[model samples]
Target chain A: MLKQVLAAGLMSALVAATAQAQTPPILKMTVIATLSGPQASLGEQVRDGFALAVEQRGGKLGGLPVEVTVMDDELKPDVAVTKIRGLLESSHQDFVVGPVFSVVMAAIFKPVTSAGVFLISPNAGLSTFAGKACSKDLFVTSYQNDQPHSVSGEFATTQGYKRAFIIAPNYQAGRDALTGFKSRYKGEVVSEDYVPLNQMDMQSEIAKIAAAKPDVVFVFLPGGLGINFVKQYRQAGLTNIPVLSTFTVDESTLPAEGDAAIGFYSGTNWAPNMDTPANKAFVAAFEKKFNYVPATYAAQSFDTAMLIDSAVKAAGLDHDRLRTALEKADFASVRGSFKFGVNHYPIQDFYLAQVAKRPDGKLQTEIRSKVLTADVDPYAAECKMQ
Target chain B: MTLLVVQALNGFQLGMLLFLIAAGLTLVFGVMNFVNLAHGVQYMLGAYLGVMFARIAGGFWSGLILASLAAGAFGLVLERLIFRHLYARSELDQVLATFGVIITLNEGVRLVWGSAPLELPMPDALSHSFQLMDGLRYPVYRVALAVTGLVVAGLLALVVNGTRAGMLIRAGASNQEMVSALGVDIGRLFRMVFGVGAMLAGFAGVLAAPLVSVEPNMGDNLLILAFVVIVIGGTGSIRGAFLAALIVGLVDTLGRSMITDFAHAVLSGPASSRVGPALASMLIYLVMAAVLAVRPAGLFPLRS
Candidate 1:
């Protein structure tokens, strides 16, 4: 009788273990960003914004635990591709986000999207994915490269800057910026200058611009190059010519340029001082956490997190269902309202802002005017989403 | 015409900065036979320290002095701890070790300052524009940079030609064994030379910080140009570095600006726009390649 009882107990324990094994551990999701490189600031902002959204959602998505994996891509396209591939393959990440440069974004698009894994681009918006090569598995929480610059051109024309000299580094993005600007502005371009991407000295270019004497200068220099150009432009006494730029004079650059950035106009999709309650709260929380004002990159990144959270909550955590829900556009963003266009780019407003001294005596950007309200990116016309 | 003059002056200023960086790199290579990739990181450290000092001292001069001193001290410590080990090792080992230092310093700066670029403000005295000619005004600060670079170059030339340490350095560059055999303390000479070389690079960084963004990886791009300058100038020759740096600065700056314009005149607007930047960037490398073809040992190779 005792031997019979022991066999029954052992069988019961085995049965319980098998049942637990059959039920897989609660679905966990991992979000990763490119956290090192020249553009680490953008990656960090996105990471912060995404984390804030997760916390606001009580640290869970779709009633299941979620995890975020922040990895450094070092801004190298190849490194980004390799690191992202490893993250997706080795770690079994439910979703992936970012590698912010368009070069890197384009590099990794094929493998990540072909595998049917969801990719949410918080900053980079490469034109190829937004048009002929649009993917069902891809969604962009950021504006296309052409959108803001197109609006900038229109705004410059409206301000009576008929003769404008355009400048950008010699790169795909640089060519795109000039193309985007020209598409909207019908005025005569006085001259277009292309400098090397890593070219730091701008004196000769500044001299040439002075010689040309254009009514205004529109530039698309990003990161360190932008800071160098703005200072050199001022040093060259070309400040008398109103300068209008895209991605050249934003929060990412404001701290570097200090008062030199003042009075220049920058066109972007989002700014920290946006007058929405969500944006206000976001800026407050982010500043408190990071001890600095968050740039548009950070705001968009935060929205990307909220975007995933909303989709995951609305449609159970099954990968396909969550992707479908994300496509439905159920989340309210800090940018007031954002909906994905047919091209997988955001249909959003673009604002013209001036770098000005705030009440706090520190240099800050203030929205001078709203250029477009719910702007549909031009690439959408080319997209064939049914 | 005045704009042309200003642009030429600007080019000269840029060349001077390049010379400051290249002079040290070439000297270390010629004498110590060290391939130190972290030299650029030291320049970056100088900029960061300058900004920090400015913040602490609340004055530009004080900050500049402190930053140069600090950078020199940091270089000494680095030599003792890291660079000393690699000096006797193979060139490949030295390259690897210095590259490691670059990575560590780049990441270290990121951790300490965060990824955001910091601003180093110009002093109140150097903030205004000075009118040199009719309808032409340039920032006083840039003019200052040019003057400062010229003065440093002059001082360097005097030291190299007239001082005991200079004799030792020149002798060490030609024959390290002979200098050591002649009762000169080779190790002490090397340490002093390394310290001075590092200080020159650091001073350039501090001077540049106000004009450029103080961010991580700021020096890497400049570092490449400095290498080009060193190669063209010939190793261990301060005068060669100065001349080569100016030539490079002028060519690069002028080529980038005018190449696109020339392209536009010859080609269609869009086509020129596409081809201009790409070609202009290749100009410097092409110059370097051409120079190398003509003189593999460089234009002014040190005479043993």
Candidate 2:
């Protein structure tokens, strides 16, 4: 009777252990985004996009219930580092998502990756992490930082422009913009100007552009800076010269920009009006839920959520298995066809998009033409991930 | 030559805006001996209120007056509730409390208006641009902005130097205890000064709304520059604030435009590319340091 009791107890314990293992533990995720100041709109889009994906899955990612913690980076690198360190110590997060600005990404990249957590960037895809510093644990759902700018460069070349005036905010991404534009444009760069990142008053810069009188102007000012620059640029009557830009004229700033941004050209990986069925569903659902037109930031973030869900579904809770599943990238992206390069950055199409007034009187980007197909980032070969 | 001409106008316009903001800040610092860091929020409130009132009043011109009045009323309310008690407190305490107010109001506006920027459409009269010179098409609204700023400065000069209230304010700035002993209601005078100062800052904001993006924390950057203006101009002198503001504005604008060429002439290509923009940003601070070193009492010290 004692032997029988022992057998029953051991069997019940084994059965309970199997049941617990099969149910899967709850997944923990931390989304660190710049959710304050002028760039807050971008972060809000990212957060909402990710939330939409999770909501569609009934608050679960890959059949496992997820508990998400969203933290604001405030667009300051130091603040981001402090918040991320506190986050790292407080909980065991399975995946870390976020950092809309490249500078914030540079700050939080190592700490999250070195702590053995997967860092999935929904927006910022800094070149520093795409090449030699690329980590097996880091995945980017967005195009490399230079790809969109390079598309503008190519577009300028195709338009038979012989002279270009380029300007960007003085920072790493700004430098990347110049390099990318120069790489494709065979035109004479009449002028290259880098303004202070927070310098809102661009009257002097506009005067300089007027003086230079380049055939085409390329600029990469983002957020509030873009809003001011575009308005001032139009007000100064310099619209006769075609302007090629990235991130400056997008859904995020179009509301304030209004008629000023109409007919302005930008380059990006995807636009709001992409013809894919998945994209259609996303744009409709995002607009329904958020009451605002979705930008590329939101699109990339939605892809990030889907990427995480697919990996988790295929690999369960195993780290190595999850990495392999993410590498496979077997999911329908809102961009239609999505795949990861060797460095885990996206190998995708780039398009030249023009800002147009939609039928509903909303300003948004409409795809003009494909600039590059199956484009691989220049830094992928330097990555040792393969 | 035309580029230079247009840029100088740009500088002057910017200077005019700075003067409007610094005019009030200097008076408060001089008369009340208060370091109200939340002065910038008054400018932000002006812009936000200007946008709202414009929507309601159905025109930018009417909206400008209503918003300025509203901002001034809000400033009076703030002074009564919080600032009145802090007049006897330490500068550090005042700073801390006002800083708290800045954060509270910034977040409050964000919650109320949402974080995206709002546009205040320029009136049809001044919406277009004119050829200031060859290759220089300047916006008419900006020119109007400068003219309005100058007119406001002139009116303020008349009131401060010409009126009975102006005499009391000057006396309070020099010797508050003596003015109180003379049976002047010093508290009421300070409140009036504070309200007028806030109104001037808001007026600057409404004028600037059409020229710049009206967003949350927009006033934060301008606030620092206003403080610099007041410090360099002499804490209480409106004339000094005007001259110093023009100097700061012209120097900042010209430095940004010409610094790259200067760097390229002096340094190698890559080095200049990096150093030029950095130096341009630092130019104003460097100017302030030099001025302070030369004249610690500022260019027009009220005490002197």
Candidate 3:
């Protein structure tokens, strides 16, 4: 009886040993996103992007067993700090992803970087981090928040728009937008007005814009504000002048704006109609899986996952080596050839995109022309990441 | 001068919309002592229904009527089923219950209408903009919105102060027991009050639908503004609501534009761009604080 029991135990032990030998170490990752409240759509896009990468890789990243834990930060900055801290302490993950809004990302910066986690930001690129606050542990898969606006400003200048007007919500991103516009455009700013983040009534502001009648109007109202502003602008009969904005009118908001958004122009890093295999494939699989167009948030997040996967392969799970591998961002991006600046933010191509109705009869972003072949951030010089 | 004229008209138009919402909110709270935080959902429902019906009936007028009727009916049904019980409950209970209703309705609307804002097209006749000044052209639809708002304010004043039903409502607001002792069907009156309040908010939603994006919780910020109007105007007083709403609206609209210009003139370009909006947004709240400090009760506190 003792011999028989020993044989059965031996067989099970062999099976366990073989399984352990095959799988080195489970790659554990914690993702924090603003998955609820006003910013839910943005968070959802990030989540899906990460999920798509995982699925395509046969549920593994870099050929290692992986576990992903996601937490919604509830669109609250303070709440994000707590969630990030909890994940760092409990999950013990060396890699962390997301929290889309700049405010939330800024709030959790200390905890995330302090914990030695590789903070892969899918969105929310702040100038603070891109410049003075840049950290070895921090990595952004998207442009520094100001770059889109900078590209648009440069595009505007190239188009010979002499007199310009800028409008944005009174927030960190908004200030950065205005600052970015000023960086490139050597023109007289006729008016630069900021409104409350939730200011719905743009009638008076629209009136002021009409009265000023700059050669072009630049705005940075994202989410619902974008839809409201565009519609109100149309209602005010201000369609004669060209409107330029970034993160304002896109696939997510274009549908909301209906016909009012038809002629709107914006600078972006990725659009569904980009003539690239990576973007085309990403869009097709995403539309098939989610039945909606992926926004810029999703594009960056997908890049983030792919970047991480490639980095892990190149550097293994070691923190210092991983950071080194990340700096050399060698991966095919949906927006095409990816390379990070010394600060760990992308220096990639940006396109001037216009809102146009798709052949499918839904409004989508159509790339008009290349804003730049490969753009480096203005803040990269300040990023002393050596 | 033209800018001033345009801004004043904008404020007046905004004020009228506030009064329409506050009229119903104040009357319901005044007589019934029911705190309905879900009142805002009625406004949202009105906009949603207007969009659906306007599309179906192929015009704006039919959409407005249908939305108003549907919203009033929805309010009446809710009163019969849920609010009737809360009337006898504690004030906190009423607030809590209504808050729950607000959450449920917001989610329900999102499920039904989707998160994308639906376009409610203005009738072609009213869609064009007319010259308010050489450079300033205002939409005829918006002018219609203001005129309709003014007319509604007048009708509300007449209904609440001069009419017999209005008198009963006033008596109930002042002394509910006395009205009940006089054999008034207070429950029936409660239904009427709730329905009318819902209808008025719905009407505003219908009117504002063409201008604003119609999405779930669109009434949320405006609801806060409506509450402020009632508080500043004096709860349960339509006259106070009208005056206060006008004050609140004018201050909110003109203050935003004027303050931005003033800040730009006083501060550095970038600094003013930052400070201008922050200060302008806070101006209304500052006014509310100042008004409350002086009045204690409100600008026109109702005599209980």
Candidate closest to the true structure, highest lDDT: 2
Candidate 2 lDDT: 0.91
Rank list by TM-score: 2, 1, 3
In model 1, which runs have C-alpha deviations exceeding 4 angstroms?
A1-27, B133-136
Residues B1-304, candidate 1: write the lDDT tens digits. 6765766777888998998888889889888988988889888999999999999999888889999989888998999999998888999999999988988899899999988888888888998988765545688998898888889889988988899999999999999999999999999999998998888788888999988888888889988999899888888888889889998888887677678778888998477877877777888788889998998877888962
For candidate 3, give the DockQ.
0.58
lDDT per residue (tens digit) for residues A2-107 in model 3: 9999999999999999998987787888778876555567788899998999889987887776799988888788888877777677767868898698888889
**DockQ winner, 2 or 3:** 2
Tens-place lDDT per residue, model 3, B253-302, is: 99998998899889985677777788888888888899989896787776
Expressed as tens digits, the lDDT of each residue in A279-334 for candidate 2 is 99999999999999999999999999999999999998788899999999988899
- Residue A88 error for model 1, in Å? 2.7
Model 2, residue B209: displacement in angstroms?
1.0
| Shift in Å, residue A280, candidate 2 | 0.4
lDDT of 1 by residue, A1-386 (tens): 89999999999999999998787445444445567766678778777877877777677765556777777666787887787777677766667777577887888887687666888888888888888778878889988878878977989778878788898887778889999998888788998887777776777777777778788888999988899888877776777888888888887778888877889988887777788898888888887877777777888888887787788778876777887789877877888878888877888888898888767766667787988899987768888864
**What lDDT would each prediction earn against the true structure?**
0.82, 0.91, 0.86
DockQ, candidate 2, vs. native dimer:
0.72
Worst 10 residues of 3 chain B by lDDT: B295-304
Could you tell me every candidate's TM-score relative to the true structure? 0.93, 0.96, 0.92
DockQ of each: 0.59, 0.72, 0.58
